[model samples]
Target: MKSERLELSTNDVKLADQILESMPGFSEKMLQITQRLLNRERQHGRYIVRDQLARGGMGVIYTVYDQDLRRTTAMKVLPPQILHQEPKVSSFIEESRITAQLEHPNIVPIHEIGVIEGSSLPYYTMKLIDGEPLTNVIRMVAREDPDYVRHYTRHRLLDIFLKVCNAVAYAHSHGVIHRDIKPENIMVGKFGEVLLMDWGLAKYVDADDNTAFEEAQDSSQIIEHNPSRTEDGVIKGSLAYIAPEQVLGEPSAIDKKTDIFLLGGTLYQIFTHLPPYEGENMIDVLQRAERCQYEVPSKRNPRAQIPKAVERIILHAMAPTKDKRYASCQDLIDDVEAFLAGRRSGGIRQFRVGQEIIKAGDKSKETFVIISGKAKIHRSVNGRNMTIAEIGAGEIVGEMAGIGQGARTATVTATEDTETLIITYELMLDELRKLPPWMEKIVFSLADRVRINSGYLHPLLLENRIFPLVNQLFLIYAGAHVQAEPDTPISYPLKDVVNEVTMNLGLDMASTTKVIDILAEEGLCVNVAEQLSIPSLQDFALFNDYCRCKMDINTGVKKIKEIQLTKEKDSCFRQIVRHLHEIDV
Candidate 1:
């Protein structure tokens, strides 16, 4: 078999230069790596390399079309110099083996692995994603759309980082640690797709306890490179994104936090368009990374104006010690989501309006509450407009749509400059579960109010009197029972009862009051302490049943009279039934 050769292009050189220029301290190293990649392309005739996708210390990535597969694929080939080193070659093989086991959407999917014929050099092909490196994208956005980047309020940057965390977290769960995570390794596609690339330095921390043959293989490779000495070792990762533990040459000591540190460094670069530290030599860079001393992300990019939540995420992820950082990538993901939801280390937030609020049908990612302004709720019906209810301050809207309900029950818009407490479904459920008993009660109460208002107004919109004053009176009486004390007389002020009936039942307060007064004058009700109640115990029982049955007021009065007459025959049963009804109702 002969080694396959491919041709390189001027555009590839230019792309390599652009990447190197953007990564200031790594310019010389990247250029050297790119030259080696070009040399490899000239040597291998099979892979039709189109453009350089990325350049790193270990290798150069190219977007190539696989003639057999008939689809574009990303090919990462190690440079001859690195491949010639036994340790580096072994590490590359180990990474390829480990990554092949990982199957996730956010991770760049590996297709196949092949070795250049007549040589020990290995290369792997993966799905070729059409996207910009997050590093370049962030830098472009920072320079051109600083305002949008800083104050867009969408936290799109955080969302992308979270997806990266999810991928790394998944890798961690599978016992693989991405030793090198930098901005250039993350790809952001046109349709908000994020792919984490470059698992070349990924290590299986648990592979140590495997078979003796595997241990011998790894040990032999390490011995060949004599990596025990600081400068003699293969240095398997890029200096900039290397974790402090890795810089200390204690690769075994590096754990999940190492990934966290790298992710934090990536975030730092994304926001500032600069690595945390810049130095002339790898030693200085490694020393600074080991020391973990750098200006805060906010200070580095004054225009970035990062939220405290985001700053905290970087700080925690980049904690100097493993114990200080998050326990896992999932923890970092949680923090990122919390930040995007506008929740940091603070008390639970109440709902507000004017924030990008979404209702049931809205596909938007935000949810909102009506804090201080009024919002009208409407549901579309038969191509006709129907106002369900009017929401005021302290009311929640958009929950139905947000909680996986495919469509919103109604649409809500801010009637004024409302301040809504915004949250995503993920954060909202978390916060809701942690709420105090009183908060739960308040939320349910608001929901009930919305339901009641919607039902009442829906009929009104159709010009149909669905709930008359008699029906409204029964609902008020039933509602009062829940709040009333057992064996205690519950009273409603004449004016209050009248107002409730008129507003909810679409009747005049005067008409409502007149009906109530007639009942009192007939000895069916009593006025005690300026509050209305049933005078006779039997009458109260009859009224309770009538209210529960949804009968007309006049019919309910007649039923009460019939019950009173029947009670005249059995005194004890009537008294007991009346008392039981009063307590239960």
Candidate 2:
């Protein structure tokens, strides 16, 4: 379990750092030098190439100024060597035309799709993005850089995801399928602008897969469906995020669903800060992606603190089968929105106030999500009832059983009339199917904690354990409802803790209310206007002590039981021995 970091030679590291500081804008400086030496000012007739921004596998990007428009823009041009083939050059030109045709907020719009005059090489001009790619954002998350972490929070990331979904939905509406939906292909602006980039691999259909490019109005701009587009059945996107159908080159299977798979992959990176699949080489990654198997995000980093519902959404969107994925990008967006709003999808049932929806030791088949109203959780402890937690709307009940931890651990009764969405064992599967094994393990372990030694503690010992358990419950309530990292004092409603206490310890309403009052009166907690605040980390301090005390009591009680049985066995042995002696006498 010992952890270590690889040691590097500090000399070279320091040398590089010092040299880099001396020349801060080394790359920009080099680009400037190249521009001046090459005299690239007049290279492109109307657009004056200023600085070379980037070089891709197929083209190089230059920051150019449109002489006619009098604005700065980005121009993509093919390298002279690659422009040797007529078909290759022609296909590149067609791709530019197609990308320029689609006009959407998320899709980068083309300003001009043309060729370098006299050379016959294709080029295009578009808005120069003022941001980094989704790939860089992911890298920042992976590195755990504090500044970036502050920038890319879980909620913020999901917000970005929602925007991306809308963009894809727009593309779908226009009969365009962005075959490549990787993080590298998506640009995120500083002001929250998300642009889906690289439409070279994107396909346009008149209606269906059988739509002929020649018959279409933009026929001259559409490349005559040819083999060069696919080499040995491989497409333009990187292997890591390409869809299964794209990998297998399933004819006519390319559609919005394929992009949905890629969107799922993009989300995978957002959650786990990792691509769905990785390998030493392109072929290796392609093989794994083609297999349509992925390591679930929760499994990859259980401590990532991502919501399980979010994970499930991504998994369903990226289902191996096209039919299994969200029918459209909008469908995926709807589910993500639902999760963000704290709503789950399932069948709902209503319970009247004071009704016992579940009973301790009852068969557990379904988990209930409270959509409204409060509920009391109860359990028998030493011949008396106890409140473990009091739960209200937006909370879950019977989850321990619903997750197959066994029969119900505690009974849940409605404190007031309640409505809950019942996620039965069968449906719970679909909800949890995408979660990592450890996520399920975490739920099971918690259930065990809640049910351990129930109804066994002596009545004299029960009061001490229950008081601290109540405090622990209070902390849980605050955590769920308040800021996780608080800068100011947090005040949570008292009723919330009442439900939590009953949920955890199965205490009755009367007992739970009594304990909350006792803690308030004892200066252990503060109560104001029915809102309560327990100093951070203090609520759980007493609980830890109670746990230790309970463990000692359980050990002592076990020994006492062993001694009583042993004494009875000794007496029985003496009687048998006396009978044998009587026979001799």
Candidate 3:
């Protein structure tokens, strides 16, 4: 008979009344039972606690009726054991203060905070959401029914995600961070309403150091014959989506980026129909979060058919290291919003084999991205048109004119009937505006370099056109690998590079291999004797040196004569520009 557990169920209350009418010597017992029932129905300072909705380690949530407001609401009450500690008690009450201050559309509002009569437990009333949590909504994404997938398409899912970002961004603005951000903690209303729930772990950053968010949580495990202590190396947030710093317990390191990691994790789940990391139990999940291991969306859910841009966005957003993630919630929102906008850009157009999609020395205002089939790049040199490259789906054509001057330098003919995304003049402008500053600079730099470097590089070297293309890959790898794994060869597996290049880089394996071979021959890269990677830091250094020398060599040289931009060069330039804009910077 634990007093703490002595609460009556709804049916128990009704049973007591029926038993009281049949028994003669139990009036006192009936009086006690009746009093308890009356207490359950009685207003706790004008709040009628109707039923228990949920319970967690921190508190119990109940459906309550607010007499003053004349409406139903949800109330969370801290258990007595937690209230026994004043420090814990203060922070528990602070939850309401912090949440009530955040007047965001997505954050659930707090109506009142006080102790209920006949119970020492502190409680706060809030909006009672009439919808399922995001966990249930996310499960709907993985359902076998085709209609569920159709209705919750990637766009629709991301649209809901943007609203979550809106609320988190608002919290950050008010010197607070919602340390625990997960699907289960979010409410997705039946009518497109999204509410950020549970500010129990939310922390207020000092106004002085804007970057440092110091939210606290007493996630302690009980120990025999000793004071409770938080689990070592375990973060206070949800294990499934906790940031690396949070797992490491780096007090100063927790900030906006910590929230960004959680945001990315949420997006990752939305795209893949799985958590970023999964394990058999809580400890296992916590360990995985600390290690920061996860499969990309494609591997996690192959049928999801997540776009490369979308996948890349989620991965970047969820980078294990804080600095590698987005700077602010706004940065993450802007990027996801921009990627969503680009996916919606331009109408799809179809082409037939041997069709001249673009031609050299001809003025073309439109740029095209192949959604299906293939195209060939050819250039006119001395009196003949020679084939330089062949590209398939996910490749771009006519971007040279889209980025810089209107003159098209290369001829691109469809290798077969193809479907393309035609971005003409104005639409191109819209995508360009959405590009991050670094990406804008990269595109502008490439367009300028192509304009300047094309004069010296011979169109005949087929490898020469490939050089410009591969250099971007090398630069991206050099930066990326060094950040993620400084001692490794930047992941130079032949198959990995080939598939990634073909799938996203808009380059075929044949051309990609040629460039890889040339890079190897130049000593800028070397395959490890018994491994798939290249030779470590030295190779990346060499690759960087070679890129610098090549840029200098081509950029410094002037045209031998008034050389016209060949169709191949023009196509290559446009391809680069399109790629730069389409993917993450």
Candidate 4:
């Protein structure tokens, strides 16, 4: 079945024209929403221009309706000035032709390319996407949550950029290079769909073609000798997103990683809400781009506190030397996925004795967990060295800042040859969420301990929270002296147990035995002579009551500690304990 499209009134066209006119640098263009509608109708047989979407450097975009097709479409019409420019005209045509061949869900589809009558330039129509450019979203975020820009931006940017990479990777596989990729050329839809736009500078990867080879050779020379060619021509990509090699005109040597660099730059801007490099003019920006070294995103945005994995991804992607960048977009994507999944994205380098693993007040990278060997935490007090704590194998150091303000509270130095597993705050949170409920309780308990004690305990103690809880819970129900054979059925011992309890409730050997005796006396557990077992619950009321008591006590203790440490009221604490007693009794 065909869908129907609506026709627009003259007033609607006038309103659209006014809207386009109000935008930056589009006022003088010959923009008529009505004219655009008429052109769409003439070209496609029947369509209507609903409104102007946006104006770009070379053209104006309008949202239109195709009456016959019953679908919304975008009309990209070149302004007269850009149409007359021979290079731009050729570029527009090439972009349309190239984009039409790209068929990916993440790449907007180009429908048709033609010259509107009475206008000497070419115009193209594409699927009108109902979304905002990625740049706009970043801007909105900057306005709303400027404080946590680093954390939020990195997540959002990585997500969108990964989709961008998937699209560009598909294009590359099809032998196309989108020489221009910037935030302005990316759109994120309401339903989380991402589309890569503007293939204007797209070039085919055919070495056998004489003209292409010659063009490639020329571009290579320009890239090698001139680092300022980025300012020349139409400047296809945003000045900030131009790769260093691209800024130097090295299009011939530009391979997949070149796009990776642009992807990194675009992500950097999105993540930080600021470009990697900024300048007052095109030349200045081009020079900074050519230098190819900028402050890491974490350094630039104090609130950003980028995870080490993300920092590594960005820096590697933006490596000035092509060899230093990721070998392929897929490699970059894999690391990003690893980071998002809360795992080690890659290996960590070993640090020498006395080496500064992390510096105080430096927020560049995330903390590292000692996989092997030992390290010492240091903080200077009154110009003297103070040993805050020593971290042995399996201990996580320098996470205090990462979880909170992201400022290093102290410096960590390796005391011996060490192999540390580095994790970012972003990755940690993701990983923590995936843990089972029992595991989560242990982890949160450890985190709470760290927060309270400030890393004073042995690393082994930190790692034993969950195991200890499980062991203690079983021991409590089975009786402290009860022993089971290796092949003994777990249900036989626990079946008659009464106290619905867990290790989280500060259960110890003695207290656990007392609870078990209470359960036995209460008939919650079945004692067949010397053997102990939990009773089968036809109605889970008793089991539910016991479990609720254990959970309530554990939660209450945690809250009380928090209140005491924070110097807050104990009213909430007293009220909880009072409620627990009433429920349990």
Against the true structure, whose TM-score is highest?
2
Candidate 1 vs 2: which has more TM-score: 2
Q: Model 3 segments beyond 4 Å from truth?
A: 1-44, 145-147, 207-234, 343-585
| Residue range 316-394, candidate 4, lDDT tens digits | 9899999999888888889888776565633586899999999877875476878888898776654545555678987
Query: Candidate 1 lDDT, tens digit per residue, 208-305?
Result: 52121122224543333321112223354456666667666665677778888889888877666677766656556657777976789889888655
- Local error of candidate 1 at residue 23 (angstroms): 63
The predicted structure with the larger lDDT, 1 or 2, is 2
lDDT of each: 0.64, 0.69, 0.70, 0.64
Off by over 4 Å in 4: 1-45, 145-156, 207-236, 345-450, 453-507, 510-585
Candidate 3 lDDT over 70-160, as tens digits, reads 7899999887766777755776798899999999899999988888888788889888999888777778767745566556656677888
Candidate order, TM-score descending: 2, 4, 3, 1
List candidate 1 stretches off by more than 4 Å: 1-47, 52-57, 117-120, 145-154, 208-236, 343-585
Return the top candidate by lDDT: 3
Off by over 4 Å in 2: 1-45, 117-119, 206-234, 345-355, 358-382, 385-585
For all candidates, the clash counts are 19, 26, 4, 14
Scored by lDDT, model 4 comes in at: 0.64
Q: Which of candidates 2 and 4 reaches a greater TM-score?
A: 2
RMSD of 3: 25.2
Q: What is the TM-score of each candidate against the true structure?
A: 0.49, 0.56, 0.52, 0.55
